[model samples]
Target: MGPGAGEVSWRHWICDARDGRLICPIDIPSFSWDMGIGDFGFSTTDKGAGKIDESGLTLPWAAIPASTPDERSAMLDSQRRAIVTTWAASDDPEDKGTPLFWGKITGRDDTWLDTSFGLESPMAILSSRYAVRDGAFKDGHSSDSIAFTGMSYRGICSELGRIATDGKQGGELPFDWTYTGERGSHDRTDYQAWNVQNLAVDQLLTNIANCQGGPDIAFRPYWADEQHIRVRFLAGSDADVYLDMDHSPVCLSSFPDGGSLEDIHVSYQDGYHRWYATGAGTDQGTLTCYVESMAPITQSMDPPVLREAVYGDTDTDNLDLLRRHVGGVAQNNSGKLMQITGSIDFGDTDQFGVPLHPLGSMWPGESVTLSIAGFPTLPDGDYGLRLMEMSGDQGSKADLKFDVLEAPFQ
Candidate 1:
């Protein structure tokens, strides 16, 4: 008999990096994995050092009762020096398993006989590989120097793709990349000129992400199969696949009546109105630009606020680009944003006696609608939420968390 609905099946194996062999784990007990693709911003005393930090997926697993003591020892040895791969699939036969996560074993915690493994995606490898030397730009350049001026988003990503496939950096590694078209108006043209002298691949990517007026591009690298890797760039304004809450076969269950919202804050300040772009050339000078949002300033909120952000090492003096950047930052930081946390009912039946939405079909970055009662502050209509984090295990329901951004034009 085939596996029933809501039942999950998983495969855990230790992969040999040298010869590409797979060894299955023994007596796996429980597993939980978290995967996210987003931007993390950090600031310090240096105003120009702000960056858009990107992260890959992280999967940690636990095992119980090894087949033998020696078997456990071998697993530990492999965890120290071997690649690990995990595959997951629902009981539905039609569901031909998906390669959930794969990477080198970064860490492990072990008792006398039991063990757990910590894993990160291949992006970790790319982020760690830095330039050992530098060279001038030549025809078919093989060195690590930022060799482009006024490069478009596609151009920079294309160069990174070349480096990844050059057999020296990570080309020989098992990953494929797909660079989407420019999603933002500013990204269509050269937003800024890059002159990075010596930097790691991850650092260059971060610089590109921090480009003034650049779209929020996500570098998501995940397993395409047991061997192939798929790198995707999810950008702002790009049309995403929408998951309908009212019609989805997978039903979402809520707590405290349904869902709850908190952390609502709004602010306005002069710093958000002004943008300073510092150029990087001998003759290039600092450019100051200002923009104003038509939205009325809310004065009733307690604790008036002011937000100021600075972008350094930028080569663009375009007023339009600066205006776009300042406007987006102002709108995002000056409005009310909330967080909605809930769970999806994959194992239980709904009130109408129908199976809930299948948790197995969800992925990060997908849009979801929430329509529930019990929140007097929240409006009655459906609220759109973006899926940012998810956690689940076999034989139980999974949790879904979302970020609610203030709607523009409202």
Candidate 2:
């Protein structure tokens, strides 16, 4: 049973062995009050001696000696610190894999677990020490690649070249999960179609123009014709490809000309409804898919568009861009972007109100300038501005403005 019955939770503790000996070089750090699978918060409620041996932990207040209560409490506290550090380090570095010890891991994410694939993961020593493949520590030297739970990685990166790889990152590998664990829209469909056009993996393509497999399958992308999949081609050697077998059948269609629906039709192969493609790509080429529920090139939500720009030597161009943000931007996770699709130009008399394009689509990490033309050239002044969400989901306007300067682009 997981926690209660049959479900495995992300919160867990793992005992570890190194060279066949019990060591304090690994640990599981936990912080939960409801489910006590592993709850160690150095509580004033009960701080004392606890035995952590070959079997597992059995820490309780009565176990410590009265004469050394402070010392025992201090040791466990340090161990707790080490464990927290290890937990943070083991929690998915760049969402990739690494080889480092996370001695103790006790938490509640469902997909986290042990490894059978040779690929390494962060390890925890039940509640003692933690490890990550991150190399180097400041001052230029290798800190212990394996550290007791409560220590520090203050200077550990540069010193160790990242526990196993060139410390390009830190932490544990992401779970190789496909199921989103959530259902779709009002539609009862539990699955979604994914498309990676002209998908290239490791270093090989999965398509061959007008050709099927033969004795010498020159640059051929193989489809089972029965299974309807262009599986990873394993020739004289296991060719590298990233399309995992975990993929399931999902509808796929093509739009050769990005045309309307009536122009497209279903394709059949070997007399089975199981096969089809839109011939959406290059004529000789084919798209291999069992089903396709959505299109490959989806129209992104409209970003804020700049209507018109009037450039000049100074602030004399226009003073209206700041009058009122007629149409703002759309947003997902990485913050808002400007989109002025329905914006209106109030005419040259108030020409400044026209939304002129800034640096186009403002991506997550890019910055650009937005200017207005035809305003009284002045040293500095405050202008009125407003920001809004497209749907007005929040039902409130962000009443804000910024200071503008008359300084020309120098």
Candidate 3:
């Protein structure tokens, strides 16, 4: 029997616009699915702003046999309108069965009888909120006029909730979401203002992340189905899973075996040691602040180390506050950095060998502790690593790339 309507398998389905239900597409010979989270890092020159990379999915269906040209045309049309609410669930019964990805069809290409569908994670929805007004006007306005002025991370999410549910933007948000209320315990007395006149929601969130100090914070959003979305605020090194070589589900005997860490890169240039800040003011007399890394300068490095500056506009002129700002920047750039990219086959079962969520089923920003035998550089300890990007087809195999979180100098 054909798959029933609203049935979900390790396959793609188009949501019926009329009734908002998932319906399997016709003539699917073969299909592949891949999805993952994006890599986020600090930008050296952008005033410590966190740089968020994009995450998405690529699904391609093999030669679908269409008996008639009219049938082919209808299929293409249906796919187009249906891209807005594309959803997928793994065939693995033990898999969370959550919508692995909720995305809009980004592209569609047809050749004879086969069609390919491109999908991106819901992050696209967040990025869609961009600066709508000019920065100059926003800079001129005081904090009192901004909606989220001096709001905590929780408060910020509440404001975002307002935006998503108000219906002023037309269609209701496809998924329901809530703030997890996770934030650092830093003094929030330093009032920060955002010009809501034209700023997008994502831009404001990015600014908040970059400027806040203490534990690094992140926002992650995921969907289980068309009607539910969960947003979580994660603090530094908050790992979702801990994988050990002997106890973990990883298949030690498989091809590509466990995983490998490589591409070690390190640098300590003048750019990494200096910080500059331009305070709030008109062109004529704005104060410019400079700070240096606490790490003692090494005389051996050529081109004598120079200073880096972070510029911003705020009401505070207190030198202590300025020092605090620059200090945060210096600490952010102090550590030697490295990255590991490889695939680990989680043996098809849990530690007890019972079949469960396929090995390698993970998300971006999720942390994992590795206890592999090789690689002396990465000792068998509880060092936290965040998954930056992951990809794999449906089954027991998967690949992941991640960044090692090195502790900043205290």
Candidate 4:
């Protein structure tokens, strides 16, 4: 079964990020969210390739009531000290809402016809802190590199996440997270080490996740109550690839004759046969690892095409970590760069007037099936929902623009 079709309404609130307390409720006439699950690049040199999800919306000055000059000024501040909470509920009489977006304000547009603001996911907040050496605050060398030895990549990400949201730097963010899924072979090896120095928390996390055996990363927002908004950070080995047929099957098909589909694009990225990566240290002591693709095509080549690239991070001295990082690039890029993109109506209905797929039907990291008959070359079966953008206004259905990946079978 696919997502339920229905009508939904929205509500917006202005809130404090330090305490998740709602400051006031404002009617948001329209809004849009460009949510991303993970890195979309194929190169290893993409250092700051971490996903920085974002949203944009306009607010009229008259949306809120302010009795004093100070009150009005505080409500319009665009320094990201405050956050916006978006909620959606079925048009049912009960109106049980589901928190949709919780992002920190990063920019404003008072110069526009209506005051508009740009917002970013918690990653923007996480980018505020530098990955200082653990316990560097007590030591005089606060800028020295920090190292994690014998811990899994998941452990490293969790520790960094905690440090970013922990109140040590100042007040903590209104966020929480958990690490779920299988542990990799590098989870607890004494000889392995991961190091960081003076890098933003978000960048460092992305570097780790993009490594050979790194976990998939994603963020979600939740409404604890009418007065609070909470954000969650999710990371795991198989976090985004799981398939639950009962609830996860989202069937989207466009017949060759006619359908509401307006546009579609299919693109592919080149893959590399040989991969190499460098880690921390320099001179003769600098650590490095290399791997070649096992893909049949690469093996069948007469000269074995030497497509080489350097990917992953340079903060680790662990040879195992470096090997996995480069190997992952080869594994993922071995002729499997097919990506599909299109726009779909979240409120479309069948001849019987039944909703086809409603808003909130799918999310980043989930899988959806597309049977696009017009494109005969398009692969069949499920594809990973890499990114999804939902845009709409107060009383209408949303339009979703999505990017999906079809992994090449080994």
Candidate 5:
């Protein structure tokens, strides 16, 4: 009932080749009843309510094929996070302010086995392991509370804020607080007017969304005076990576130019690293804050951000120009680099994208792979590899356009 997972423990169902399981794990989010489209943010209805998984942008959702046994071992040994197939409570939707927890639902999105590789002898059996956990937060911080989870949309954070504002300490609910759903504005319209302590709900909402964009954007409280948090975008193919995080040069001075995860300390407690409140309001004891990660959606994730300069010739006629650009920004973070394992988007309608391999053709579904080792997939023509970087919502996202410059879609 306390805030935790792992200790409560559960069994990791071993996938069997004999039983025959085949699907791209990268496409789980598109089929996830809780995080995917159909179910939206609400829990499942039918006990076994299910949807065929469609390959979508890869963000390490539970949908990807469960990690290979070796990959699982390495993940636990390396990353502090563990892998598991999380789940949501399968009941009570119309309860209005009901809180739900996520468990047995780890992974990026879908958990399936890649059958095409035929790595496991075309019949090799691969499975993932699971260790039981206690004090799992999924069961709710307490029997009466729920764990922090992706709530679905960026614009509807008020649903979650409503709960934190009037938490069940037996106090009055926030029906009295002015509510508005304007884009980018904090959930409560009266956010600035609230007592200091009450600002927690508002600050938390912003912080959660900030976290999804990585360390580039700080999710701290906004004060009425002084400078506000400024944002910068580093463009990439299919996704946008943010660079500026309202950090001062003094703080950047301490950051190592190059180091492992262990060498960096971005201050998880401070506004940039972790979460914090803003605007020292006098009476309400300075609005406090607590934030969860941004809500899960089928949005494309920016991979490693890339930055580069360009030199080119322009056709000023009709602006029908052709140019040669050397390097652009990474799709994920802003580190000096030429290449990285990243993801971007074409558009909401163009979801088919995957890690480019050698000699492969286009396919149906949101997930795809282009293999070009010894064969041709793209049509013969001049194709432009244009990278984009956009900033908004105090963060940014991007897309990589691979189109024929002088031809039609083949």
Candidate 6:
């Protein structure tokens, strides 16, 4: 029989994180993945929580053994990993299925008939390792300082990833690592310099990527073969501009001519009106910038409430760059930012009848332009989809949460 419409098939595989060797396959009856770039749709806090996908799964007790050393190692407690692949019901299983997630097993719960495991994206795994110090204690001088002199953002992340994986940096990691995409120009002088001390690999990477005008970074997985699953580093400021997805510029309009979005809810936060930023140097020599909002929201405050913030960058000494950095930060957080949450029904189509594949079409850090009727506060323009919380089981619609892209006062 042909597969029914809206039917989706899922497959799970437990693999050795070190070498990507297939450890075992299990039938996961149900699972949900919540993946995104930042904390859930909040504009004020640090958005450096880079692509930390989280999920939980339950498996039959017989699927993975407890006594076998290899199987036990493959279990969540041993820091092994799992990959989830899915496809349309009609697609042949012999073909390579789309890899939805690849994460390390972090926690576990066991019962007589079933066991549940917690899975987190690669950033969570990297967080466990710290950025290696520049020189060992045995090497005469020991320093926690790591320097990036005029290096592109992509190069910085690549170096940090290498430091985390290569034993020479600290200890060799089992899994392979590689990065792709470019951020700044190849001109050495064009890139900025940065120095960090005693930071975790994940923290260092996020701090760099979340800076003013930084590119988006994601840990993406690709199916290699039965024995290997490949994960690649993707970083780019204009990543989506290269895609040719026909459904893009997808409109979620309530107007008669367009398709409608369901369960639309909007909330706003009181963002800071004044920003004070310090970079490099100490005492009176520090480079600093201070700016206050002149936006509509700030002006509307009856008594003109003053919300202030202080920011620090450890490596930049250029005063102009520091000003630009604080300027961008102030612009993003100066007004009341809107946080929108909604869902698109499975098998739904856009106004032009293009099938809406929420997960397939849009990703975190990509841009989406839409218009809603009731919320005239949000102008019809470009908005960034910074965080996506996708949760569903089997054949179900995925819930989506989009954090504010820009200040609404604009």
TM-score for all predictions?
Answer: 0.60, 0.18, 0.58, 0.74, 0.16, 0.72
lDDT of 6 by residue, 1-410 (tens): 11135334556677766656666565554444555652111001112443222335556666664566455544655454554444433346664456656766656767777666666567877777655643433344444344555456666677667766764543544434444223344221212112224356777667656566555677666667756776666666333321223345545543223444567667777778878899878899888888887565445655435688998875556776667667767777876677877766545645765456534455554455555654556655445454445544444465667757455563
For candidate 5, which ten residues in a row score worst on lDDT? Answer: 117-126
Q: Candidate 1: lDDT over CA atoms? A: 0.44
How does candidate 6 fare on TM-score? 0.72
Report the candidate with higher lDDT, 3 versus 5.
3
Each prediction's whole-model lDDT (CA):
0.44, 0.20, 0.41, 0.57, 0.21, 0.56
lDDT of 5: 0.21
Candidate 1 displacement at residue 258 in angstroms:
5.4
lDDT pick, better of 5 and 6: 6
Off by over 4 Å in 2: 5-410
**Considering every candidate listed, which one attains the maximal TM-score?**
4
Per-prediction count of colliding residue pairs? 7, 77, 12, 3, 75, 2
**Residue 397 error, candidate 4, Å:** 6.7
Q: Return the lDDT, model 1, position 46.
A: 16
What does candidate 3 score on TM? 0.58
Candidate 4 has which clashing residue pairs, if any?
44-311, 212-324, 212-325
Rank order (by TM-score, best first): 4, 6, 1, 3, 2, 5
Cα lDDT of model 2 by residue, 1-410, tens digit:
11112111121212121111111322222211110001112111112333222222333334322236464433334223122111111123321111111223222121122201110112122112122332333344433323222211111211222222222352222211111122211111111112211111110111211112101111111222311211111111112111122332211111333211112221211111112322233445422222221211233354322222221111111122111111110001112222211121111111553212211111111111222222233223222211111110011111111112212311
Candidate 6 worst ten-residue window by lDDT:
38-47
What TM-score does candidate 1 reach?
0.60
Q: Native-vs-model 4 lDDT?
A: 0.57
Model 5 lDDT per residue over 1-410, tens place: 10022111111111211211211122222222221110112111222444323321123323334457666433222112211122211123221111111111222332443221101111010012111112222432322222223222232343433343233333222121122232332222222211223334434343333333311211111111121111111111112322221222110001123211112111111011122222333456433332221211113264322223222211111111111011111112122212111222111111343212100011111121222121122333222222111111100112112211221210
Between the candidate structures 1 and 4, which one is better when assessed by lDDT?
4
lDDT of 5 at 87: 23
